[model samples]
Target: MPVDAVEVGDLLLVRPGALVPVDAVLVSEHAVLDESSLTGESLPVERVAGERVSSGAVNGASAVTMRAVALASDSEYQQIVRLVEQAAGSKAKVVRLADRYAVPFTVLSLLIAGVAWAVSGDAVRFAEVLVVATPCPLLIAAPVAFLGGMSRAARHGLIVKGGGTLEQLSRVRSAAFDKTGTITTGRPVLDRIVAAPGFDEKSVLQFAASAEVYSSHVLAKSVVAAAKQQGYALLEAREAEEIATNGVAAQFASDATAAVVTVRVGKPSWLREFAPTLAPAPLEPGELAIYVAVDGRFAGAIVMRDQARGEAGQALHDLRLLGIERTLMVTGDVAATAEPIAARLGIDEVHAECRPSDKVRIVSAVQPRPLIMVGDGLNDAPVLAAADIGFAMGARGATAASESADIVNRYDTLASLPLAVRVGKDTVRIALQSIWLGIIISVALMLVAAFGFLPALVGPGSRRSSTSSRSSVLCAPSDRARSGVRIIADRHGRSCGP
Candidate 1:
């Protein structure tokens, strides 16, 4: 049946890798779900019968039956989409610096021209003042400087949209960040292996990896990779079977004993069916433990976690130095999982277990104006679009988030963010400098012409020369910006800054 046709109380089967179409209650005895898109949890979660699962979570290694509890339009995924549309529609347009000064500059120029004409009664004097007071530098300087800045940002792996975005970026005082894939690596890795009584860690790992190699679960892949990294020689399974959402059971011939050894690897609940004496492994926040059993006896446990990016701490520190006064982390993960990462990275606040709308609300409430939101998931799209400046970690992020962002960081590193800020600040500084230079020179020439010190014949030529000099001043910043970025990159070793 089509997802749109799914009504409340309708029973539906969710196949492995397929998204749940609506909010539903699980009908199967056990199921595994990947809720990363909705919750930012890196690891898949196990759900038993009678548990409710939200829409958009990917079914993992199992075809489970569920009864829909909400209509497709009212589902969690659809609600997030609606929030994104609403947020994007309501986002305020950034006012350009040039535009803000245009009306005032025009009034000032015309006033000076009219005064010259009225006092001197010389049309020639009036023409000369107007010619010198023309806003060429004001008109051209900001765009050129912003283009130069955008070019520099591009070289450093940031794709800034327009001059206004650069202006907003330069003024960013607060920043909100998504947790998984933004601060953390997003991929689960084996943290440690704990062997039960009568079992060695190596033996437990070897047996788990041998059986897990044939399973399609994400955790299984991590276990296999860890075993390979540790130089474990995996024994080929003589017979293997995978029970969806449960565990993998396999038989492997022992090299020394010359007998078939039975092994099982999966959730503690699944392993407990075979090894009734299995003890639960202690876990810290953000950690996941996979249990292993050998020939109906409890063997050991493999602990896994999504590790924080190596450069994340330094990147946050650089942002603080760049004048981002407040930093907050908003994530769909639980507080226990997010607080530690926030504290370690020096983030001032943590909003955990956020839905997409919740993320938008939290980020929208952040103070000190010109807020920037950085994210890399579908759940982050709405909040990204709502922020004053949205930076999408696009290298491996969702397409929706990238599309919604004002600036897309092409590199898979947070180092580009602070570099982008520096570029914006430099670009805006150069633009304002050029504008002021043009205004001062124009006003001086206009006064000189009005007072008969400069001939009308020479006035236009002097204005042209002044405009040329201002253009040169605008272009010089690009070179300086490039050199400055290169210096920062060298000083930080390219991982912490760009």
Candidate 2:
């Protein structure tokens, strides 16, 4: 049946690896679900009968039955979609900066032309005044400066989609970031190894990696990769058994000792049967510890975590220096997992446990107009479209996020964001300078024409010369702006030009 036809109280069958169609109460006695997309939790959750599993969570392993508790439109996933549409609809159209001055300048020119005609009763004088007061500078200068900025940003590994987005970036006062893949590396990595007494760290890691090599879990891959990275020679295991959502057990033949070694690598509770007194190491807020057992005896633990990026702290510091008044961390991860990272990165605020809708609301409510939202997930797509400026970490980010973002960081680093801001500011400055230069020269020529000092017969030639001079002045700033951007990028040890 179509999801639209799913009503409350309807019984639904969710197959393994399939998404739950709607917010539902579990009908099966036991089930496992991967809620990472909805909740940002790295680990799968176990639910029993009567538990409400949210829509969009991936059912794990076995087929399960659930009773629909909400209509499809009112489900969690649809709510996010609705919020995105609403937010996108509410976005104010971007008005070109040059247009703001064009109206006033045009009105003033018409008023001057009318007065000149009235005072001298000469139609040629009014025409001369109007010709010299043309708003060419307003039309030409801003776009050229913005294009130059966009090109410069592209060279620095930032893709700014439009001139207006670049302008908004220049004026950003606040910034919000998604935790996973934005502030931290999205995948788990082995942090450290704690070996039990009489067991060395190398042996513990080797045994665990050997067993985990046969298990298909995200954490297992990290462990195997870690062991291989350290050049640990893996032994062949005979009869490796993987217990779903628990751990893996394997028996390895020892080449040197001429004996069989049994190893267990998994959760503490799962390993407790073999190592009754298993004592796993203490974990930090965002860390996960997988216990290891060698020949039925407890053998240390391998601690792994989604480590924050090395450049994260420096990037936040640079943004603060670049006039970003407030920085916030908005994530679907829980507060306990998010707070430490936020404090470490010096973020001003932390809004944890956010659904996609919650993220949109939080980012939308952030004070100071022109806020920037940086994210890299499917869940971030809606909020990305909603923010004043959305920056997607595009190198490894979700396609939806990249599509909705106004600016994309192609280098897989946050360093481009500050560079983008600097470029925007410089570009806007150069554009205003060009506009004013054109305005001043045009006004001076208009005054001469209005005073009858410049003849009507010579008016077209003078206007051409004046426009040529204004073009030269306007073009100079683009080159200077490029040089300034290069200097700024160089100061930050980045290449900002072709």
Candidate 3:
């Protein structure tokens, strides 16, 4: 059926290799789903009876029966499509700096020509002065300056899309960020190891890591990495099975100290309920635990947490100095997980548990016309396109984020954000300088032309002089980009351009 015709509560049979057309609650025994396309989660998730799954997840190995939770128009994937389309279709206009000066400059040129015609009583003199008054500097030199700025930013590893983006960056009044993969490392690290009775921490960790080697869950990688750090050799496992979102089970090969045993690791709800003897460990705030069981008996738990980036503090501080009025952390993570991180980073506001549509609304609702949003994930794509200016941290390579953003931080550093702003401001300053420089020279030449000192035809001097002004604008950056470029002025960080 067409997506539009699909109604709520409709039971749909999602076969293997099929894309889920709507948000649904799984009705089958189990549903293995690849949600990476919507959530930026790399591992496949398993949804069992009554568990809700979003649209856009690819159904895995087995067929699944699901009851639709929402119509297609209300699904997550379709919502993003709507946001992108609205942003694309909206006829918002951006006035260019060059264009800003065009009208007045033309009026000034006509006034100068009319005055020359009245003074010299020569029709030919009016033509000469008018020809010399061409806005070539505003037209040509400004864009060249912007291109150099783009090239300069590229040399520094920031992929600015166009001069318009640079203009937007220079004028940013506030900034919003997506938490995961934006301000934090986005990967969990093993911070605590809690072992049960009859098991040492190292032993539990080794077993868990050995089992995780056969899994691709984000937490599994953390457990394995922690084991590696401790210099423990993992035992070889014969067969392993992932228990959906709950945990994993693996059978270890018979070794010197023990016979082949089945080891399971996952959530407390799943493990503790099945194994009543399992020791229940109280979880600390911000700490997620992975429970381990041996032969259906409770073993222990591995506690992990994601850490904020070391450079995040400095980056936010720099944005403040650059006059970003507000900084908000917008995330889908719950307040319990998002607030402390925001406080630690000194962010002024926190918008937690935001869906992609929520993020778009947040960005669109900001008071100031020019706001910058920075993010890196599939979930961030819609808001990125909707924001006044969007920057994608393309450290992990091209993604939906990179496609939607106005600028891509190819260098993968938050610190580079302030640098982009600074470069944009300077580029606009130089571009304006170049444009005005040409206009001033031409106005002076017009005076000479009015007195018949120059011919009726436009002189080569007019072109040469305007062309020479370029070197002052472009070539002054002798190795300046190599050493970090300084903010050209303390006051030029006002708006996009004059």
Candidate 4:
């Protein structure tokens, strides 16, 4: 079927082993969906009637009938594809100073060899100098060092997209973080269940979880999970309606109550707007709280809070010691919610209530240039592409953010960011050292050849000296030095910054 011709509410038959055509609500009693490609879930999800299934999911053994909720261009999969194209394509190609250094030395070698041949009136003299003066260090040493650095970084569980990302990391002056998932654990757990005068805590929670279970929002999942953990049985909700930018409404089938009752879950304002007869409870000091309404009355509220990552503070401290001039946090969360976390993490600046465009604008205004942005949400994708270097939390991060990033921390830690910079600087330094070593020895041999000293083959210690120089330059710097290079860890336990 043509994607453009697929209209909303059109019925589409999805066969087993085929990709879902569009974002559709399932009409079948049950459909096993493999959403690893879209949502990165490891196991298959069993979705039933009234559940929305996204495009790019592989159908299971049975055929499924679905009603299209969105067109191809407006779908979640298409949105992610656009982000990947923009993020990967927008970055400018980086040029290495080490590669530029080789150009001038090549010219110098040619000039010295040419002069020797012309003055001596022997083409054989030029051949002798050329044989000794071959620039193997420029050709072999730098690329090997860079490759070594990449491998070392991989051992630490980071995936640097290319050599350019390492080069960018080396000179980074500032770093900005996204507060929710990057600095704090993205998971917000339910903390307190505050119920109204007439309602009990358990009853309100059960009703709220039952209604919220139908939503795909992150908060909804948390509510359902918390209810399950507390041993509350979730009832089957009929005719569930998720109001646009508001609350979810459903008629709960409960054995405890004789009649079917209306239940709602969402923000207080949203609940009030959707159900005018329902009264909303006042909000307390938290961001992750959701209100619940039973029938036409206020039932209670569920408060949730996010925890800061264990390694977060230490990573910020390491970044400063790694010679980053400034560190900041940018988030869409309010000042009250964002500032306390920023203070705990030791961030120098904070930009609260930031939109995706606001984040890009903030990055452009950052002083001294060469900024790095670290984030893990789908909303952070655009700014990740805009920054000089972007580090994505790849373990449980959004696909769009990961694809947009220059460096992806594959594990659930930020410790590798500083290490990557150190390795890149060291690689460049070692490459230069090797190149100069080869050039100096080659020039001395060329000078000796100018005199036609002994013969080209009989120069004292020449072969031994060349071999020794190659070994020192080509090998890694540590215990694995024979095979690879590691970050040069000094006595102070601090990375030697660029």
Report the number of the highest-TM-score candidate. 1
Q: Which order, best to worst by TM-score?
A: 1, 2, 3, 4
Tens digits of lDDT, candidate 3, 118-233? 98897766666665665678768989999999999999889998898888777888999887678877667877888888888988899899998887564676799899999999
Residue 378 lDDT (model 2): 67
Per-residue CA lDDT of model 4 for 126-200, tens digit only, reads 655655665666667777777877888888888877876766777789999887767877667776888887989
Q: Each prediction's Cα lDDT score? A: 0.84, 0.82, 0.77, 0.73
Model 4 lDDT, residue 465, Cα: 22
Instruction: Give RMSD (Å) of candidate 4 vs. truth.
Output: 11.9
Off by over 4 Å in 4: 1-5, 8-71, 74-90, 115-123, 190-286, 290-302, 332-336, 352-367, 458-498
- Better model by TM-score, 2 or 4? 2
Model 1 TM-score, 2 decimals? 0.85
What lDDT score is found at residue 231 in candidate 2?
A: 99
Q: Model 4, 402: alpha-carbon shift in Å?
A: 2.8
Candidate 3 regions with alpha-carbon error over 4 angstroms:
1-21, 31-46, 57-74, 155-157, 196-200, 215-218, 238-246, 251-262, 273-277, 284-286, 294-299, 367-369, 394-400, 410-413, 461-498
Q: State every prediction's TM-score relative to the real structure.
A: 0.85, 0.83, 0.78, 0.62
Count of backbone clashes, every candidate in sequence: 0, 0, 0, 0
What ranking of all candidate models by lDDT puts the best one first? 1, 2, 3, 4
Give a tens-digit lDDT track for model 1, residues 112-208.
8788888998766666666566576766899899999999999988999888999998899999999999999888988899999999989989999
Model 2 over residues 289-377: C-alpha lDDT tens digits? Answer: 99999888999999988878889998899888889999999999989989998998899999998888788888888998789999887
